[model samples]
Target: MGMLKLEARHLLAAAGAAVMISAPASAATLEVHIGSFKNGGTIPSKYAFCVPAAEGHTTGGANINPRISWSKGPRGTKSYAIIVYDNKAPAEHREMMNKEGVTMTADIKRHNFYHWVLVDIPPNVTSIKEGADSNARVVHGKPATPSAAGVKGLNDYTKVMAANDATKGQYYGYDGPCPPWNDDVVHAYHFAVYALSASSLDLPKDFDGPAAEDAMKGKILAQGETVGLYTQNPTKGAKASK
Candidate 1:
C-alpha cells in the first residue's frame, strides 16, 4: 500500500510537469514606428506630393520618403515587406475633384490608394532612414527596380498619372500623399510592415500593393502599422480630423 501511494504521487507530479512544458508562451507583437510623423498625427508637408500653395489650392511638395523602423519578428521570420497607402481617397464624385467652384465633402466614400510597395527586405534589415529610398519627386516617376535593400513595386500613381503624357509612367516606390486639395476631409495614411516566412515571394517587378499583399497572404507571420494624417485642403489644417 505504501509503494502504490508513492507511485501515484510521482505520476501526478509528472503530469503537472508535462502540462507546464507544453503550454505556449505569450506571443510577441510586431511594432512599427515612423520617425518623422507620430502615429495618428499629422504628416508633414515635406513628405507629401502636394502642399498648400499661396497662389492657388496646392503646389508640388518636397515629397521625401519618411524614416521607418520596426521590431524584429518572432522566430522563423525570413524577410519583411513595407506598404504605405492612403485610406481616405475619395471614391465617388470624381467630377468635383479639384474643381474651382465645388467641394468634395467628407461624406463621400473613400478607398485605398497605394503610395509605396517594397518587398523582400532582408531579415537583418529593421529600419529605413528618411530619404534613403526617395529624396525628391521624379517627374516621370522612378523605375520599378530591385536593389540590395528590397524590390520597389509600382504605386497607384501609375494609373493616376496615366492621363498626362509627361507624368504618365510606371510610378514606382514612394510618392507621398496628394489628396484632393478641394476635399473637406482629412486623409489617413497607413505605414505597415509585415514579417514574412518566405525570403522571397518571387513577385514580378511590376507588382502593386494588392499583388504584394496576395503574395504575402499565407506567408505573413506577423504585422504592424502606424497611421499618419494628411490633407492638401487649406480649410482642414494639419491636425484636423474627420
Candidate 2:
C-alpha cells in the first residue's frame, strides 16, 4: 500500500505530528511494536524493500505497514492514530506541489513520499490488520479508510499527484514507493502510533503535513513506533535484503 508514499515522507512527522492532539491525562506508557515483534525487533526479509545489491529493481513486497499494537497510554486516551513514512529520504521534505519541496536525481523528481495516515481511531483499538494497507489502496483518494475502525487522514501526495499526465489531483490516502533509482542508501519507514485524549483531532479536512502536525502540538498522551525499511531494489546475495 504505497498510495501516497511520496508525499507522506514530508508530512508524517511535520504535518501529522500536530493533527490529532490532546493533553494526556493518563500515565500509561505505550510500547510500540510490529505485529507481535517488539520495537527494535529484527527487520524481516518479507518486509525489506531495499538492499545494498538490489540496485535497479522494484521489490514485490507489501507496503511497509505492519501489524501494530500498543499499551499503557495515559488516561483519557479516547483515540489513537497511526502514520507510516520514510524518514530517511533526503532532506527534500516539502509540499510536492512546490518546486522548493522537491529534489532532482537522475533527471527525475524525488520528494517526500507518504505511506499511510489514519486518524479518529478509537482508544480501544489495540491492533491493526497485518496487511491492512499493504496493497497500497485507498477510498476517495484519502490517506486511509479509518479501518471500519477509524477515520483516514489525507496524505500529502493528493495535492500534486496526477492520475494522468494532464492534471494534478488531491491524494487522499496511502501511496506506496517509487524511491530514487540511484539512492545510495535504503530508506527507513517509521510507523508511529499516537494515543490521544479524543477519538479525533480538530483540524481542517484538507490540511497538509506541517499544518496537521501543528494541530496536535500538545495533545498526545503516549506514543510508540514500529520501524521498517523499503526501497525499489533488493540485494540478490543477502537474505532478500530485508
Candidate 3:
C-alpha cells in the first residue's frame, strides 16, 4: 500500500510539470526608442515652436517629429497607437501664466498636452522615420493623407492656438512641444506606444487624444514609453521661487 501511494504522488508531479511545459508563453513588454534624444535626455530646440529671441526669431527646434521605433510587442497585437504628451504643461493655469510676471514652476500641478496622436498603425509597421509626419514649419493641421500608414488625430495645439488668429485652426497630427519660455523648470515629454488587440481603432476623423485613449481602454495588450526633456528658458540652472 505504501509503494502504491508513492507512485501515485510521482504521477501527479509529472502531470503538473507537463502542464507547465505546455502552457503558452506570457506576453512581453514592448521596447521603444527615439533617435533624436536619449531616454530622459534633453530635446534639441529644432523640434519646438519658434520663440522670441534677442538676435531674431528662433524656433525651439525644427518642428519635425523625431524618428521613433518599437519592437517586441505582444503576440496578438494587431495595431498600435502613439501619444506624445507633455506632462508639465500648465494646463490649469494657462490664463494665469499669461499674466505679466507670472511664472510656471516645477511645483505646479501640470496637465497633459497631447502633442501627437496617431493610431490604427498596422502591426507590420514598426517605426516612423524622422520628419515623415511633420513639417519644418508649424502647419495649422495635417490630417492623415490617403497614402499614410496611420490616422492622425487632433493635438493640443488646436486648443493652444484657439484664440490666436494667425495660428488658430484644427491642428492635427504631430506638433512638437512649445512650453512657456519663462517656465522655471524643464518639461518632460512622454512618447508612448500602445499595442492594441484590434486591427483598427475605427475612430472618427475628429478624434483627439482623450477620445483615442477612451477607445483603447480595455484593448491595450502592451505598452512602451520614452521621455525627452525640453526648455525654452536659457536660465536652466535657476530654481523656481517658493
Candidate achieving the largest TM-score:
1
Candidate 3, which segments miss by more than 4 Å at Cα? 1-27, 55-61, 96-100, 237-242
Which is better, 1 or 2, measured by TM-score? Answer: 1
lDDT of each: 0.78, 0.51, 0.70
lDDT of model number 2: 0.51
TM-scores across all candidates? 0.85, 0.62, 0.80
Superposition error at 131 for model 2 (Å): 3.2
For residues 1-242, what per-residue lDDT tens digits would candidate 1 score against the true structure?
A: 12223233333333223111111234345799999866666777789887777666777888899999999998998999998987678788877888898889868887778998999999999998898787788898988655447889999999889999988999889999998888876676788888888999899778998899888877777777777777777666532222
Put the candidates in lDDT order, highest first.
1, 3, 2
What is the overall TM-score of model 2 with all chains considered together?
0.62
lDDT of 2 by residue, 78-130 (tens): 88777766554545432331133233342233334455666767877777766
What TM-score does structure 1 among the candidates reach? 0.85
Q: Give the per-residue lDDT digits (tens) of candidate 3, residues 156-229.
A: 88887788888788877888877776676566777888888888888998889889888887787877677776
The better candidate by TM-score, 1 or 3, is: 1
